[model samples]
Structures are given as C-alpha cells and as structure tokens.
Target chain A: MRNLWLFLSKYNAFFFFIIFFSISIVLFVRNNSFQRASVLNSSNQIVGKAYETTNYLKSYLNLAVVNDSLAAENARLRGEMKSAFYSDSIVKREIVDTIQHQQYSYIVGEVVNNSIHHKDNTITINRGRKHGIKKGMGVISPTGVVGLVLNVSDNYSTVQSLLHSDTRISACIKENNAFGSLTWGEENYDPMVALLKDIPNHVKVTKGQHIITSGYSTRFPKGIAIGRVRRTGVKGGESFLNIEVQLSTDFSTLQYVYVVNNLLAAEQEQVEAIQPAK
Target chain B: MIRIIINNLIRFVVLVFIQVFLLKNIGYYNLATPFLYILFVLLLPFETPNILLFVLSFLLGLTIDTFYDTLGINAAATCVLAFVRIIFINLTVQRQGLETEPEPKLGIMGFRWFFFYTLILTLFHHLTLFLLETFTFSDIKYTLIRVVLSSIFTIVLVLLSEFIFFRKKER
Candidate 1:
C-alpha cells in the first residue's frame, strides 16, 4: 500500500494534465459545429449599438472626406435621375412600385473598423443586441452589399466583409442573367474575381455589365447593386468562365452602413426548412 | 509565485491584443498572422508545475481560437508543444545539480543556442498549426509555403520582442 501510494503521488501531475487535456478536446469536439446565436454570437445587439456610438465618433475624424464624397454622390445621382426619367417610363413606374413595396426596414449604423487587406477581412460596426441586430443579417453600404453579420454583442457586431476569403455572395449578371459565386482572389485588391461555372462560351459577356444580388438567399434582398464585370474569359480546359468584378463599395474606406432587418426572415426560414424535408 | 502569475496574465493580454488587433489584420504577401503567444509557453519557469503549465497552454490557445473562429487548431498545436517541452529542454541543456530551476528566456542560453532552440520549437508549432489548418496533403506545397512564411515571421517577431523586453537587463 505504501509503494502504491508513492507511485500515485509521484505521477499525480501527469494524470491531471491528461484529464484536463481530455476535457478540452471533448469540449472542442462537441462545439465544432456550433452555429452563431444571439447569446453566443459576438455581434449581439447591445454590443452592436455601443460600437455604433464609437463609429460615430470615428466618423467625426473623417467628416470632411465623407462630406466630399456625399456631395459627389449627390451630383452623380442627380445626373442619373434626369437621364433615367427620360430614358424609359416603364423603368420609372417600376422604381415607384419598388419604393412602395419595400420589403423591410433598415437600421443605419457606421462601420468603426474596416479592413481590406486580410483574406478574411471583417468590419466592426456600432450596433448590437440593443438595436435588435442578430447574426446572419445582411449589411450594405450606399454602393452595394458590404457583408453579412457573423456575430453580435450588446453594443457591437462583426461583419464578414465581402472581400473575405469565406464570403459567398449570390451574384447574377444584369445583362444576361448569368449567375455565379462572387469571391475575392488571394492576390491584391486590383480586380475581384468571380467563378461563373457552367456558363456557355456562347453567352455574350461585355465589360462593365452590371452584377446584382439574386433573390435566392434571404441575407440579401434582390436588386442590391453588387458590382460591374471588369473582365471575363474562358478557362483553358474548363467549362467555366473566369470573370473579374469591380465591387461597388470601396472597402478601403467604409462608414454609414445599413443593417437590413428582414422582419419575415424567421418565418421564411421556418417555412423553407420544413418544405425542404417534405 | 505571484509575480509569475501576474506576468503570465499580462503576457496573455498583450499577446492576444497584438494578435487580434495588429497581426491578424496584417495579411501581407499571403503570409499568415505570426503567433508569438507560444513564447509564453516557451518562457514558463523551469520549476513550474507541469499540470499547471498544460492548463495554461491550453487556455492560451483556446482564447486565440475563440477570436479566430477556428476550433482546436491552436489548442492542438500548443498542447503538442507543451507535451514536448521537457524532452527538448533535457536534450538541449546539461544542468548542474545546484541549479534546479529553468530560465526560459533565450538570453540565458546565448545567441546561437537560443536561436536554434527557438527555431526548432517554433517550426514544430507552425508545422502542426498549418497542417491542422489545411487538414490535407493534396495541397502540401501551398501548406509548406505557409508554414515557412509563418515560421519566419514568428521567429523574427519573437526575437524582436525579446530584444525589446530584455533591453534593461543582462543575458
């Protein structure tokens, strides 16, 4: 008994280490497939709002630049509005109807931290659980889709920027309705790439053709302007067309984003989830 | 003991802040964010309890994984390093009977020995981490490149930090 007790005591630390290691492995394995919820999510609404305040403070530092851009946008919009009114009466009617049939309300916030450099670039916004921000909501700037909200806290939320390695936006060509996944390349931010697989070589793709979100996903509503095609060509031996798109939003300088609150998103998801099994 | 604990805690906060705030965003030239947090594991006092060391290492890795949204990669790498630490130390150092404690900072070992020691261990840590991250051998070339790039950056940063922190004292 004395010998056994001595042996046990001698190796107690090693045993404890093994036990703790096992516990950590088990915990990690169990949570491997964990999805984000409001509670565990980093972008919880309360934190989102707090970050929004911080973002507002940050914007104060760039007020002059923002004002200049806003003025430029105003001029561009006015010019487009005048030409668009005379170009087509049908387009004007559709625009009016779209305004009337707006699907969801928006909660405006400013992006406090934005990065275009990293492969998994994320944007931090000031808005959170207090503002009813939730995970998987779509975020957009005036130009186009910015990203999707991944995590939320009480006063801050983190967005998986469109330039991220994992971002998969549902994009369709405006001219020909050809659809593809718009993804960023590992290279520098010269021209963003899109993988338009299974596109027939015969399809006429032109430079500067507009690309917009397809209504297939709930994260983004249809008709949000994404980007324009800058270049396109057929892969040497593959059936896919390699295309590059210039993003509408300048990720280098981002602020004043709108979080889309899809009021019926939960209901829609529930229905879709059930219908798929049926 | 209190000083050690406080130092480890402070190191933890500083490493994580540098990681998430600065290094994580620096995706220069397709290289990864260098992990210098393992330096804490490498620098623990020689006489520290092994079980406590393991726990501390796991916690450090897990904290990083939480922010990165990666599951188990850093923890697995850190655990492997912690497990092999004693053996590596034994192989590298011939201790006298009178000196019972370990001095973790490379300054104690002289430049050449310290560089070799840090290089081997950092390489091991990076290899395990990047392999786990890629999780396949099909793209071994790319994975190898990443390992090399990350290892180089990690080594440079670790040495730089030592230089900065150890400035006031002698080796």
Candidate 2:
C-alpha cells in the first residue's frame, strides 16, 4: 500500500495524463463516424463467416439420416409396383389404390426347394396356410407364371412345377388368341422350353409370339405371362400345331415367388361344379 | 509566493479566453489556429513541481478543447508540453542561478535560447496534437501541413507576446 501510494504521488502527473487521455479517446471513438463504421464492419464479417461454417457442419452431420430415409421410402414403393401383380392393365401412377380391391393378394416367399433337372420336378415354398397360401393357388416368378400350389402345411407348401410331365396349362398367343394346351414331355428337361398342343393347324401361329395363361380354370388368372413361342410346326398330316415355347422364368436362378390369394376361388369352384359335360 | 500563484491564475484565464473566444474563432488561413495559450506553459517558473505542471497543462489544453469541440487532441498535446517544458528549462538555463527559481522569460533565458526553445517545443506540441487528431499515417501529408503551418504561427505568437509583455516585467 505504502509503495503504491509513493509511486502514485511520484508519478501523479503521468497517471493523471493517462486517465485524461483515455477519457478523450473514449469520447472520440463514440463520436467519430469512420472509426465506428470500420469497427462494426469487421466485427460483422467475422460473425457472419462463423455462422456460415456452423450451418455447413450441421447439414453434413444430418446427411446420414437423410440417406437412410430415402432407402426406406424406395423399399415401400417397390411393394406397390404394378408389374408385381397378375394384371398389367393398371398403369403405375401415384396410388389409385381405391380401384383395386382383393382381386389378387400375393404371399411372397422364397423357393426352399426347386428341382428342374427331374422329369417330375416339384417346388417347395416357404409359405403355407399361416401366410394365406392354399391348395390350387397360383405361383409365379417375376418373369412368368410358375405353377399351382398342390399341398400345404402349417408353414410350408408344395407347388407342381411347370417342368413336370403331367402338368398342363392352357395358354394363348398374345396377338391372335390361338390358344392351346401347354405341356412338357418326359424328354423336355431342358428347364427352358415347353410345348403348346391342340392349336389347330389352320390357325396361324408365329414364332416369337408371347403366350400367356388362358384363365380356363380357377387355378390361375388370365394374361399371366407363360413364355414366348420359340418354334411352330405341323407334322405331315397332324391336325394340330406343335409349338415350342421358351419359358420366361430363368429356373436356374429362381429364388422368390408370389402365391396368388384368389378372394372368390371357393365361389368359382362351386359354380363350376354345376356345369354339365360339354 | 502568493503573488506568483495569483499571477499565474490570471494568465491562465486570460490565455484560455483569448484562445477560445478570439484566436480560435478567426479561421485564419483555414489551417492555422494561433495557439498562443501554450505561452502559459512556456512562461511557467522553472522550479514548478512536475505534478502541478502536468495538471496545469492538461487543464489548459482541455479548456481549449471545450471551446473548439475537440475532446482529447489538445489535452494530450498540452500535457506532453508541460512535462517537456520542465526538462527543457533545466537543459537551456545554466546552473549559475541554482537556488533561485527564475521565470522562463526572454530576458532571463537569453533570446537565442528562448527562440530555439519556443520553436522546438511548439513544433512538438503541434505534432502531438495533430497526430492525435488524425490518428493515421495514411494522410501524413495533411497532418504535416497542419502541424507546420500551425507551429510556425504559434512560435511567432509566443515570441511576440513574450517580447511585448515579459519585456515590461524584465524592466
């Protein structure tokens, strides 16, 4: 205390000068226009740059969450695609879902067992009654109609493969409605070809024409793509056309299939029973 | 001792009034403010205490600022002047009259010594004040012009007043 007082009294003039000089400076800064403008401008520039950097960092941090939501949304929309159904007449605009009731509801399942190399090939699916799959329900791959469900358990079902000998399906050419009974012979184990019979020889048939299911029975829907016509010939005096078809389903890589849930299958079966033999 | 105090008080008032009301009002040459008030600092007794000298000079410059609406430029310059005035007198005046405190008049301090003293100190005061006011070297030319013109005028005025009034005191 004593030293400080001594110093103050000794350099009292210098201290007083400094005090008064500071006061003058404060007043000058408050009053001067140019100094005020320069101070505010530089300070604002620094603050604005800091805010912009923080905003950039915030957006970068949120990018992962944004990407996750986009992937989930794509998965949801894939389930509602028109090509995944038994009908292609419905166009894929946004949600005209009110017009489509339960004409077809598909139970998606993976093929647990597929035997394409055998003469009596059969497929085992990982879906059954618990998933609304029943006997006589049609199954299909993304590219073509596969077969009908023959038996069911609690959690599994068996489908008669289109590659089997006794299996027969009615098919028609897309261009001309010249339908025939589709069959695979005992020797037809190539897994890529089938035969369409009963097409009249006089009916015009073209190679490379698309063949689709004729919906003659309650088993499958009409217009389900079966395959494409690969070859057509009439033996010397045969009354019917022998047409070879290339199966659209690539059996070697078959993994997923959808089982059709026909809402009126029981009613249609009962109505068919009363028809007399033609 | 009382008479010296009274005389300095009178000189302080007279110089401040003349600087604020008369000299500063006339914008002579647009660059020169004939700051003859520093004459008070020049004429203060050589033996004046350092603290008192600094305070007197600060107050003198602040008084001029209040009139001219300038806040700190004059106060800071005058405070520096007050401090320098003491060292200046000690350097210029001889040790022959060591015991007695002689007034820094043209008669007591020889004219040659006083002229140089006034010229140097006045230039210092003008430099400090103008530098404070501009506060930048970007317009150094303008600062230099203001200091030179104003210092020359202040030096002449300080010499004139000393010759006119202090001559009567010396006689």
Candidate 3:
C-alpha cells in the first residue's frame, strides 16, 4: 500500500492527465459537428440502440399509456371500417377492407430518439431504407404532422422536427383555404408554438382554427392536420396575417409516427418540370 | 490541511456562481467575454496533490461546460491547463518561495512574478479553450484576437481578486 501510494503520488499528475485527456479527445471527435450525420449523433445507431435498450427495460411501466393510445387508434380504425361498410352496403364487414392507395403509403415506426431544446432539433426512427423509408418523406403521428425526413441510413432515419427554427411546412386554414408556411418562432422555448405566415389580409382567420398541410410539395398529403391558431397578429404593413400556431403533436410524449412515402413524387416533379417558366 | 480544503471548496463554488450568473451576462459586444472560473485552476495551492489538481480542474471545466453547452471543449482545454500547471509552477516559482510561500497569492509573491505567472497560464488556457471552441483554421485571426482579449480580461479579474482579498498579511 505504501509503495502504491508512493508511485501514484509521484506520477499521479501524468497518470490522471493521460486518462482524462484521452476521454476528452474521444468525446471531442465524437461530438464534432462535421460528424453529425454519423453514428455519433444523439439519435444515431449507438445512442438509438441504447435508448431502445432502456425503453425496453422501462416499457412495462408505461404499458397503461401505450395501451390507451393504441386502443384509441384501434377503436377509431374499427369505427371507420364499420361506417364504411354501412355506407357502402356492398361488401359485408366480414370481408377485409383494404383501401390501399398507390400515391401515398404510411410506414409505421417507433421514434427511437428525439430532442426539443436545440435550435435545430431532430427525431430518429427505427425505420429506414430497409423499411421503404427515404429522405424528404413526411412523418406524422396518429394525431398530427411530425416532421420531414432529413437524412437516412440503412437501419435508421433522422427527422427534422417541427420544433427546429428552419423547419417550414406549407399549411392552410381549414375554414378558409388561406395558405401559408408554418415555422417555429425566433424564441423556441416552453410550450413550443409555430408561426403561421403569408395568409393575405382578405382571408378571414380566427383563434382555435385547424391548420393543415397543403400538399404543395410531395412531402405531405393534402389536409394532414398540423396545429391550431393560438395567437393572431399583423406584421408591419405586410398584407398578411401573422399568427402563432400551437402544434397539436406534444413532442415530449411522441413515441410513434408514420413515415409518409409519396410513391408518385418523382412523377410529380417530372411533370412540374415540363411546365414553362410562368 | 482541512482549512485548505475548506477554502478551496468555497472558492470553487463562489467562482462558478460568479462566472455563470454574473460574468456570463456581461457580454458587452458579441465576440469576447471574460472567463473568471479559470481563476479556480490558477489559484490552487502549489503543493496540492497532482491527482487532486487534475480532478478539480476537470470538475471546474465540466461545470462551466454545463453553463455554456460547449461540451468537451472546456473540459479538454482545462485538462490541458491543469497538466501544464506543474511545469508552470516549476518554471515560475523559486525554490525558496515554494518552501516559504505555499500559496503564491499576488500579495505574497509580489506584483511582477504574479503578473508573469498569471499572464502566461491565462494565455495558454484561453488559447486552448478558444481554439477548441472554434476548431477551425480559417478564422485563425479572429480566434487569436479572442484569445488575446479574453486572456487579458481574465488576468485583470484574477489580479483584482488577489489584491482585494490578500493585501493584508493576516499575521
């Protein structure tokens, strides 16, 4: 013990420096911004795998909440099927109803990781190219629009969450068809609110009205609900109504979202390209 | 020994609070701000255990990192500073002073020795920290300016504290 202490005392500075300095360098390279899209990211393979492990351990604790949301979704789906059968009066409810469309298909996936506090927040899902997920695809929960896919690796995909400052989604007022883009305000703090802008002065708007995606770009389908207008305003001399939209998706509680794959996106882009400059 | 531990513990808490709450809010222009928490690493007793110095500086850097959200940057720079500290002491303090003056406060060490010691160490720390923060050679000029200005700013604060607290010899 005396000899060990003597050795450590003699060389402890060099010893400790070597240990801590290597750890710092390891973390430094891992956290470098250029490597953001790699496995070093918060939602990349390494951290995602860790989160999944932890969630697996604690999932039983959250069984009730998970069951409740799943039950609600299942009930909604069953109700819609019943209504469809009754209204159609063609195929009996016994026959399976498959209303699959070629244009847009949803790939359900779990949010392996997510963040909200950063200027540019991102979400990562277990779904990837292996699961027909691709970049620029729109992600939505059962309740509302989640975000657009920013980057995708083989087994994972990162989403540009709505909480990000630069995330702009095309939105339209449900009551009046007044279209605008939704953006997170400069101050992205508690109770995250998106600013809906560019609706002309002529269109009537009101608080608590539903705003939804316009399907302008092939990212989101038309009428995918986004948020409700919380506060309304007018910027200086601009002939547009400036409004704050309280996003319906409570990002903190988000667990699962469906990645929207627009199979016809390429065709749409090609068709739009042929149009001469107006 | 206990008194030394108590004093250092108190200084750690006070300097961290001052750096995070007070000095952090005093950003006059966009570019440069003083980092007073380096004073904790600077003023540690000369004869403190090498392991303790390393650990203390690591914790101090991590605390500042928590405030700035520049994770790993401060910790690495501060670790470098702490590693270089023993060499700095060897270079600056005379053998007689090391024996007589355990704690090399400016009042005891006299103005010139104190200035040179603080200036060089502070510059080394600021250079490492700002370089890590930028981590790019393209803005070398801007980074150098930041290093120089912030080092001077931190030095001034350290000297001010030394004069305020240690001027009277508590015989």
Candidate 4:
C-alpha cells in the first residue's frame, strides 16, 4: 500500500498533462472544418474590432503619409474621369466595360500594427463589423494587395498579410492572361512568387510585366494591382512559367489601407455553389 | 493584497499591449519577431495553482492564435511550456528554495543564472512552437535554422523587454 501511494504521487503530474492534452486535442479534432470555420468567423470579428481601435490611434500619427497617397490616387482617378467621355458606340461600350470592371468599394484604415519580418505576420486596421468589415475581405493599399481580413470586431479587423505562408492569392499575367497562384517567399518581405502552369515557350515575357488577379476567385476583383514580374523561368517536365513579382507596396512602412467589401459576394457564392466540382 | 493583485493585473495588460502593439510589428528580419507575451507567464506568482497556470497559458496562446489565425498551435505550445516551467524553476533553485519575495525577474536573481534559465526555457518554447506550427520535419536543415534564428530573436526581445518594463526599484 505504501509503495503504491508513492508510485501514484510520483506519476500524478504526468498523468494530469496527458489527460488535459488528450481532452484538448479531442475537442480540436472533433470540431470538423465547418465548426472551425465558424469559430474563425467569430474570432475574426472580435480581433477586427480590437485591431481597428489600435489602427485608429496609429492612423492619426501617420496622417501625413496617408494624405500623400490619397492625393495621388485622387489625381489618377480624376484623370480617368476626364478620359471617360466618348460619342462612338464602340467607345460607349468600352466605357461601360471599364465601369463594370472597376466595381469596388474602399474603406480606409491605418496599420496600427504591421510585421513583415516574421514567417507569419498579421496587420490590424481601424475598421470592423460596425463598418461592414467581415472575414475574408481583401485589404489593399494604393500600391497593391496587402492581405485579407481574418478576424473582425466591432471597430477593428486583423489582416493576414500577403507575406504569410498560409495566404494564397489568384494571379494572372497582364500580357498573356495566364493564371497562377501567388504566395510570399518565406524569406523576404516584399518580393513574392507565382506558380504559373501550362504556358508555351513561344510566349515572350520580359522583366517588369504587370500581374493582376484573374477574378476567378471571390476574394479579389479583376485588374486590382498585384505586382510586376521580377524574374521569369521555366520549370516542371512540361513548360511552365515560374515568375517572381516585386510587390508595389513596401510592407516595411505600411500604413493606411482600404478594406474592400463586395456587396454581391454572398449571392455570387451561393449561385456558384451548385456547379460540379472541377 | 488587493493592491498587489491590481498591480499584477495592470502589469499583465501593459505587457500584452506593448508586446502585440509595438514589438510584434518591429522585426526587421524574418526571424526577429519575438514572443514577449511570455513575460506574463514568467511573472505570475511562483505559488500559482498548477491547473490555473495551465489554463492561463492556454488562454494567452489562444489570444495570440486568434490574432495570427494559426489555429491551436500557439495554445498547444504554451500549455506545454507552462507545464514544464515549474519543474525547471524547482530543479534549478530547489537547493536553496524560492524566496519570500515577489516574482521571477532577472534583477531578483543573479545575472548568469537568470540568463541560462531564460535561455534554456526560451529555446524549449520556440522549438515546440515552431515544430507544431510546421507540423513536419520535411526540411530538417531549414527547421534547425529557423529554431536557432528565432531563438536569438526571442532572447533579444525578451531581454530588452525585461530591461524596459522591469527595472528594479531601489530597495
């Protein structure tokens, strides 16, 4: 009896650790994907509000830089507005097409917290659920795609920066219109990589070719600036383009960003749900 | 006692705020982002209940995971680290036993002992975390590199944080 008591006392802590760990693992594994998704949604909401408040305080400090970018964007927009006029039916059709392609809404935010050095980094902004910010909303600066909304609270939202390994954005070449997946190279902050598939050797590519989203995904709209090709090469048994892109945004000094909301996103997703899996 | 509890609570809030707000964002290199949140875990009362310690560590990790969207990776790592912390503290100081003083801090303990203590524990924390985060040892060489690089960053940031926030007042 004495020996048994000593043995139980010696092993008690280990037993406790094993028991607690097993229970937590069971809970984590049992939830399934949809339940995890919902938890992510709620956490995203709370984090968004917390980040948004922090962003609000930091935006005030970064007003000078933000004002400069806003001015530049405004000037570019005004120039396009002037050139929008045309009497010809072809020109009118082109104008309507441009308008349709340019469909986007921008909500301004500042990076209260930004990290580019880590393998995984999150950027928090000063906008949240109260401002219609939701999980999966794309974050952008005047320069390029920054990240997507992961969590949102009442007044702030956290963005999963493009630098993160988990972040995947659909991209296409401007000249050839070939689609590929863009992801951050874990080592760097700005320059990103794209995995392009099934492109023939005949297609001539050059340095600094513009790359944009393919609009195949609901996360981002077409023609929104992504980056420019930094390097082009062939890989795989068949010919494919391995492109390196220099992101327009300097993530190191990131400040104000726009949280984008697509009003038709939910409806579009619902309609597309019935399609057979490709 | 109430004042002491309030002081600890205030310290917890301040440390977390500074960690998430300022330090998390300031890493100039890929491996430089530090986990200053461990300061809360380190500063907790030595006599804190074992179950309470585990629960608090888990909650702290969950908060960070929520922000970074890394699932339960942080929570799992923190729980393990918290469980091991008591054992390390006991093994190292059991010869002399714990003081009647406040909490663990470098100033309270001598320099070299504290340094080694923090280093060994910090390495353990980072190793478990990165391993869980990666979930594989496919790139064994690269994984080792990350562990070393991230440990240096964690150490520097933690030391700097201790200096800045935990300066010992004249007794």
Using all chains and alpha carbons, the TM-scores for the candidates as numbered come to 0.78, 0.41, 0.57, 0.79
Reference-based lDDT, each prediction: 0.72, 0.72, 0.77, 0.70
Model 1 error, position A268 (Å): 6.6
Over the stretch A1-278, how does candidate 1's per-residue lDDT look in tens digits? 99999997786655655675576566556544445323422344433444455556767877887787778768867877856555643554534444464568788887866666444567877777799899889998877889898777777888988877667888888887877777774333342444433456777888999989876788888878888878889868776787777777877667788999987787788888875444
How many residue-pair clashes does candidate 1 contain? 29
Q: Which window of 10 residues has the lowest lDDT sum in candidate 2 chain A?
A: A35-44
Model 2 residue pairs with clashes: none
Order by lDDT, highest first: 3, 1, 2, 4
What DockQ values do the models have? Answer: 0.30, 0.07, 0.15, 0.37
The DockQ-based order of candidates, best leading, equals: 4, 1, 3, 2
> Which candidate gets the maximum DockQ versus the true structure?
4
lDDT digits (tens) for residues A14-45 of candidate 2: 67667756765675566453333222211123
State which candidate, 3 or 4, has the greater lDDT: 3
Best by TM-score: 4
Residue A137's lDDT within candidate 4 is 86
Which structure is stronger by DockQ: 2 or 3?
Answer: 3
Tell me what fraction of the real C-alpha contacts between chains A and B each candidate also makes: 0.16, 0.18, 0.30, 0.23
Misplaced by over 4 Å in model 4 are: A1-8, A19-34, A37-49, A83-115, A120-139, A149-160, A185-202, A236-238, A252-278, B1-7, B99-103, B160-171
